[model samples]
Target: MSRTKKDDKPAGWRKAEIIEAAAQCFMERGYHATTVDDVATRLNATKGRIYHHYATKTDLFFDVHRTGMDRLFSAIRPVHDRGGPARERLVAMLLAHARAMLEHHTYETVVAQGVQVHRFDQTTEGQRQTMRDLIATRDTLEQLFKSTLEDAIAEGTLAARDVSIAVKVLLGGLQWSIFWYRPQPGETEADRVALAEKMVAPLVAGLRAAD
Candidate 1:
C-alpha cells in the first residue's frame, strides 16, 4: 500500500494486490478461518491498508469471487469465439479452462469455496445480492460451455442425450481439481499444460461422438 510519488501505481493496482493476497489466505485457511489480518500479513501490510480499500472481509472476499469469474470468461472466451469445428473448439475451451484453473489456482479455489458458502446461509442480506450477481456470472460461464456442447452435438461431433447434464459432468471434471490439485515444487507452465492435457483427454474422449 506504500507508494512514493516515484513508485506510485493506480488504486486499481493496489486493490488487485490486496485481492490476490486475500485469495491466497482464503485458499490456505478457508474463508471462515482466514482473517483480514491474515491477508494483511500475507501482503506485509497493515489491517488499515486492507480496510482502506475494503470496509469488510466479505467485501474483499466478493471481489476475489468477481475476479475469478472475470478470469474464467477472459481465458476461454477467445477459444469459444474462434471459428472452428465444434468438437475442436470444445476441446480447446476445456484446455483453456483447465489451464486457467491451474494457473489461477488460488483465485479459482477461493471462488469455488465461495460458491459452496451460498448453501450455508453465510452471507448477510446485503451481501446476498452481490452473491446473486456472482452466481449469474458463473451461470454465464456455464452457458458458454453448454452452447458449444449443443453445437457439437448438432454437428455430430459429440454425443449427449442431455446437453445440460453433459455440461455439468464436463465442468465438474475440470472443477474437481480445485479441491485436490497441489502444484509440485519447480513445476513449470509447460508442466501444468501437460498435466491439463492429461486431465482433459479422458473427459473429451468420453463425450466424443461415435464413428
Candidate 2:
C-alpha cells in the first residue's frame, strides 16, 4: 500500500515523504542517474507532484542529506549531553549513531557519501547556506566526540596519540555501518542491540588507557 499520498497529513508531511523516497532512490541509483521522475515513482506520485515540493532533484537531495543529519543530531543529543565518564558516554553515543544508521538506512547511507555528493556542482547562495547549516550540525557532533576524547585523556581513562585523529577514526568506525550492516535473516531489534553492544566492547577496549 502507498504510505505517501497528497492528503496523508499536510504539506510538510508530503514534502518529507518525497525527501525520504528521493534519498532511497539516490542511494540506489546514484545522484547523477536519478531524476525527479524516479523520486515521484518511488512515492507512487507524478513528476508534477515531486516538482511541486522540490524545484529540482538537487533540492530534494539536499533535503535528504539534511534530514539524515537532523535525525542523527536529535537521536544522539541525549547521550551527547549527559555527563559521564568518557568511555561510558562515548560508547553510548556511538551505539546510538549506529542504531540511527540502521533504522534510517537509506537516508543515512546517502548522507555517509556527502564528500562525493559535494563534488557534483555549485548551488545558489541560498542552497549554499543550507549546506552550511548541515555542515555546522555535523561539526557540532564531531566536536562532541573530540571533547569527550580530551576528557578521557584528562581523567586517565582512554589515551590517544592525537585526539582529533581519534575522533575521526571513531566516527568513521560508526559510519562504517552505513556501508556494511544489514539485518541477517531472522534478526530482531534485540539482536541489533546485542550487535551494538558487542561492537562497542572492542572499541572501548582499544581506547583503554595504557596498563
Candidate 3:
C-alpha cells in the first residue's frame, strides 16, 4: 500500500503484495507460463521475497484462488444470511455477485480458471488439493441459491422443476460475464451495478411464477 507507484511494498503488507502481483502474472502469462520470478519482477522485489511467503508457485496459485473465493463469499454471504423473503434475498445476492464479478475482474478471473487447472494433471498434488478445497467452497456458495430457491418455491414466488438445475443456471449466468464483461472507460461503480442488474434480469425473471 505504498504511495510511490514503483511497487514499493510496505513490510506489513508483503504477503498481500505477493498475492496481487502473482494474480497479475497468472492472469497475463497463465499458471504454467508464470513463475515466482515473474511475480517478483512485477513486485520489484527479489525472488526470495515471494519464496519467504509462498513455498512454491502452486502455493501462490492456491492463495490467488483463496482470495477470489473470499471475494465471492464476502460479497454474497451477508445478503444471503439477512432476514427476508427468499426472492428478495436472492435478488440482493445476485446484485452483490454481479458487482463483485465486475469490480474484482482480475482476481475473479483466476477463480474461474480453477476448473481448468483441476483438470490439468501436471500440477502438484498440493495444487490439486487446493482446487478441491476451492471447489467445495464454491459448492457452498451455490447452496446459498438452493436455500433461497426453496424458500421462493414454498411461497409460490418462483417455480422450478429441479432446483439444482435452477441454481446452476442462475449462478452460471453470473460466471459467464467474467468472460466478456469489460468496463467501458470512465464508467462509475453505479454504472457497473446498473449493468449487472441488467445482465441478471433474464434469469431472475425466468424464475418468477406465472401470474
RMSD of each: 2.5, 3.0, 3.3
Flag the better candidate by TM-score, 1 or 2. Answer: 1
Q: What is the lDDT of residue 47 in candidate 2?
A: 96
The residue-level lDDT of candidate 1 at 41 comes to 94
Write down the worst ten-residue block by lDDT for model 3. Answer: 1-10
The estimated TM-scores of all candidates read: 0.91, 0.88, 0.88
Q: How does residue 184 of candidate 1 score in lDDT?
A: 87
Q: lDDT for each of the candidates?
A: 0.88, 0.80, 0.84
Query: What TM-score does candidate 3 get on C-alpha atoms?
Result: 0.88
Candidate 1: clashing residue pairs, number? 0
Q: Locate the minimum summed-lDDT window of 10 residues in model 2.
A: 1-10
Residues 115-175, candidate 3, lDDT per residue (tens digit)? Answer: 7777774867767777788899999999988989899989888766598997898788887
When summed lDDT is taken over every stretch of 10 residues in candidate 1, the lowest stretch is 1-10
Q: Write the per-residue lDDT of candidate 2 for residues 1-211, one digit (tens) a residue.
A: 3444446688887787788888889889988899888888888788998888778777788899989988988878889899878878878888887777777778888886665666666788887787778788889988988888788788887765698888888778777887788758887788877777776666667755761
lDDT sort, best first: 1, 3, 2
Which digits, one per residue and each the tens of the lDDT, describe model 1 over residues 1-211?
3448423878888898999999889999988889999999998889998999898898899999999989999999999999689989999999999999988888899898886677765668889999999999988898989999989989997766787888888888998998889888999999999989988989877655761
- By lDDT, the better pick of 1 and 2 is 1
Q: What does the lDDT come to for candidate 1?
A: 0.88
